[model samples]
Target: MIRKDRAVVWGRFVRTRSGLRHHHPMTRKIEEAQPTWFRLSEESWNEIREAYRNGATAKELAVRWKVSPSSIYRHAWEGGWSKKRSADADARAHAEAIAEEERADQTRPDPEAGLFGPPGADDEAMLGDPAALAEQAMAASVRAMRARLFVEAEKLARLSEAYGRMAEKRGGPAVTIETIDLETLYDIVMNKDGRVGERFRVDPDDPGPRDPILVRYWSHRYAEREAFKEQIRRVRANARKAACRAVGLDPDAPLPGF
Candidate 1:
């Protein structure tokens, strides 16, 4: 119900009559059915940038976007994108933006236990969880012990191999402690005749008596090897105890030996 004094142009209700039906100057523009071109979305902005990178002219983009080139130029300038620019500049700017984004990511506050880490994440947080702490402690202790044992075992293997080879060469199945003295024992195991005494010959033409220092050297080597084996035994025992205690097991309790 429009009053006779009011006229409706488009949605505006002006004075109406039966003879005056279509008389709007702006109606022709609407009648042409122009597509929407205002308030570009972020996706549209990216598309504009992509088009510019692909060397598309502003006129082409304007035609595709249903806007004037002037609008395209204004939006591109404000968005920090350029037209008629070299690909090198585009790539350089892209890399810089990526680096900037990476920097921002590093600065972003990433709280532990947020999604990836275990719950109760904080300094020494594992100490509060007995099970977690025990597991970690046991794992660390076992790793250390295993590494030590690996090195020691390799040394022992080399020593045993050398002793076996030397024993075989000396026509003895094994080194025995049945010799009369330490010097005789060393000589028997070292492939030297024990009966070869000091001044066995009278003349310099004959081979001089076996060097007295050889017995001393072999005796010291034997003592050092025995001591090293004892030390290895004590270290292994302590390592087992420490590992056991770490996992809340009794250190004195019998464990499956490695």
Candidate 2:
């Protein structure tokens, strides 16, 4: 059996641990019995308003004020305290909206600009300006033409290489030198409906004809090209994931690519 004094001490200790005190029950009873209207000093109310305006959360303000977060919210609501309007916020939203509109506009080709210009208007525009403007326009046109020619030349070079390889494999007649209709030939070669063979009337025994071997070679080449494209796509995806991981983001989480 425990001593009476020790038992009382132990009970008091337990009550204290459980957050009960001598005045707790009486205070609760008194509060329940009485009508209450809480009031605060003007300074205290100003401090609360300032805390809310400065972005201190209600819960944080409650901790500082020794009150519940809900009480802080109720007081703020009742006292008409609210977040202050920020000029920066308005500016940022406006800028974002403008940027979005610009991005959308970029996808649509304007008839007055670049490759989408009216059919015969571009040449006249290039020639119609003051000396400097005309010179600049001519320079731009020349640059564009040069770029197009370079691309065509590069494509012809690749086709010539392919033809050379084919000729070497066949061990037939040497490749004769002539200007090739490269764009037309490229379209024909890439066509799926056997249109190239039909257009050229390529008989099995005809000389300098594109044969099944050439078609099979190009088919394999296309497959390899697709595989390369897939590889590039995978590489870009992995790079994005790695970047996200570096910034403490979940790599597997869905994200807007744009």
Candidate 3:
């Protein structure tokens, strides 16, 4: 049993009905009673420690627990609590964000993408597969060759148009001189009165021909057209070879019986 108005220095003194008496649970004398206002229970201290550990500030804890911020501060100081800098935390978060951005970059589309092509552009994945890469390489090479061919064809058309304009001015008929893509087209055809000194192969395989068309319709321009045949042959070599082989015609032996 306990009595009221008893000073409890660990409950060491009490005033009875007869007189004041001395008592100690452990026989130790305490001069002053523990101040109840400043003291806290083990359960309450445990809660405070937990709240501080889990990111509670002194002001936050003070308001929640109905205590002074000073008290909360004192408790935290004794418990050795500290809050990490907000900047440091933000930096770490941004570092993770940058890492994620790099991972996405692995598949990000390049604006200047070409040469081979973009991944999955046409039944070809541009990653980690040798056979698909080889096929795309071949396709890119073919595209380049065809592009050059188209450019050459456009140039040839321009030259032919120039010949047509020249013939209209001279009142002469359109001739085979317009068939060439030569830079010398204008120079050759400007003098049509000269003899046509041009010669060509009767057969690609034989390389034997001494015939000349020494007429008004043939000249250096005609010779140029004959020479241009060799250029055309080179340009169509691959396709012609493929076609010849497909039809059982020897590509190196020229057209048979010609």
Candidate 4:
């Protein structure tokens, strides 16, 4: 029950009823009809601000906290939270890409494993037999060549897909080739035979047909793979010749080709 001396204006009781002279229930309800403004505690506001700066969107925060997006955006603006969001988002994307690449590297099969050696072919046991060594060497070389080509083709497919996506963007940065590692380039040059080097040589000086960077990397890698394979062939052939002479057979005899 309200005292006769007190009057209610809006929701609060006033000492004087100067303007609101009559205390009618209907008038009091109408005056107090406005909804209360939503507010967050200081601690909750700080948490929201930190989340916004750390790459969380205002809409996401609103849904998660059961609050309106306007409220989150308001606090975000007042607290200067928008500037860091894009930077944090980029950093998160970079980190995720690095993690995905590491995982792929871990799961990928090693292309160079057993390239020069046939499965279950003992080099020592075959040393006494010239024909056996020659056949094994040829089969091993064929298998190694096929493996290398398969890996190169897989890389090219993936590179093509990536470039296709990049092409969809207008006014995007031009695709750039990375500098070849000096040590790796040196190794490729040193291992090169006349045939492989001439066929797959990577000429950075070439001006026309500006292919993507990954295509250039693929060429360099293919050249290196072929050069290494050639070196293995020569080494294996010499070993077979030595074994033929040791077994009292003709060293210069033509080896059987697969």
Task: State each model's C-alpha RMSD to the native.
Answer: 29.0, 25.5, 27.7, 28.5
- lDDT score of residue 214 within candidate 3: 29
Ranking by lDDT: 4, 1, 2, 3
Candidate 4 global CA lDDT score: 0.63
The residue ranges of model 4 lying beyond 4 angstroms of the native Cα positions read 1-81, 111-121, 127-131, 144-258
User: What's the TM for model 4?
Assistant: 0.23
- The lDDT of each candidate is 0.60, 0.59, 0.58, 0.63
Decreasing TM-score order of the candidates? 4, 1, 2, 3
Q: Model 4 misses residue 194 by how many Å?
A: 25
Give residue 179's error in model 1 in angstroms.
79
| TM-score on alpha carbons, each prediction | 0.22, 0.22, 0.19, 0.23
Query: Residue 165 lDDT in model 1?
Result: 50
Q: Per-residue lDDT of 130-224 in model 4, one digit per residue for the tens? A: 44544544555566557776664454444444444444443354432356677656666686556545555557887756446658878778899
lDDT of 3 by residue, 146-224 (tens): 6565554444444444444544545644445667556457545554434222332234375544334323334676789
Candidate scoring better on lDDT of 2 and 3: 2
lDDT of 2 by residue, 92-116 (tens): 8889999999998998765324422
Candidate 3 clashing pairs? 196-219
